[model samples]
Target: MALKILSGCINCDMCEPECPNQAISMGEKIYEINPDLCTECVGFYDKPTCISVCPIDVIITDPAHIESKESLLEKFKHLVNTDRI
Candidate 1:
């Protein structure tokens, strides 16, 4: 599944750099995760790097974009092949 950043973000700038797919970015008030670009690190890591680096533990699975592991892997492959990673 894709991940989403909750509202408690301090904008510490930790998660943004950790995201392998470049899915995290500065939103109007806090860091945001783009579901379309998020694969939960399926292709780059065993776990999500952004979640590991986030200090406040505000990152969580996006219920709106629920996806299976195999689906996430396919998305990762697509990002890599399309040079969007």
Candidate 2:
């Protein structure tokens, strides 16, 4: 599943660089995660790198785009395979 930044975000630049999928980006008000690119670090790390680095704990899973581990893994695999072609 994709993670969403809450309203309390401090506009900190910490989370974006930590994303293995390179999914986080600066939004108009705060940082945003690209659901199409966000794999929740399923293939790269044990935990979500953004969540682990977020100092204020404002990151949470997107309920609207909820997904399973298997789906995320599949997404990651697709991304990896796509990068080759």
Candidate 3:
């Protein structure tokens, strides 16, 4: 599943650069994760790097964008093939 930043995010800027897919970016108030680009690091790492580096546990799976590991891997492959990574 894709990840989303919760309301309590500190905007620490720790996640944006850590995302291998460049799925994270600064939003109007805090950082936001692009669901279309987020794969929870399935193809890049065992765990999401954003979550790993987050000082606060504000990042969580997006229930609205639920997906399985296979789907995430497919998305990762698509991103790579399209040069969107």
Give the Å error, residue 28, model 1: 0.4
Candidate 3 clashes between residue pairs 3 or more apart in a chain or in different chains:
none
Error of 1 at 78 (Å): 0.6
For residues 6-26, could you state the per-residue lDDT of candidate 2 as single tens digits?
989998899999998889999
Instruction: Please estimate how well model 3 matches the true structure, expressed as its whole-model Cα lDDT.
Output: 0.96
Over 4 Å off in model 1, which ranges? none
lDDT by residue (tens digit), candidate 3, 1-85: 9999998999998999999999999999999999999999998899999999999999999999999999999999999999954
lDDT of 1 by residue, 1-78 (tens): 889999999999999999988999999999999999999999899999998998889999999999999999999899
> Considering TM-score, where higher is better, how would the candidates rank from best to worst?
3, 1, 2
Worst 10 residues of 1 by lDDT: 76-85
* Candidate 2, run of 10 with poorest lDDT: 20-29
Instruction: Kindly report which residue pairs in candidate 1 clash with one another.
Output: none
Candidate 2 ranges beyond 4 A from true positions? none
lDDT of each candidate versus the true structure:
0.93, 0.93, 0.96
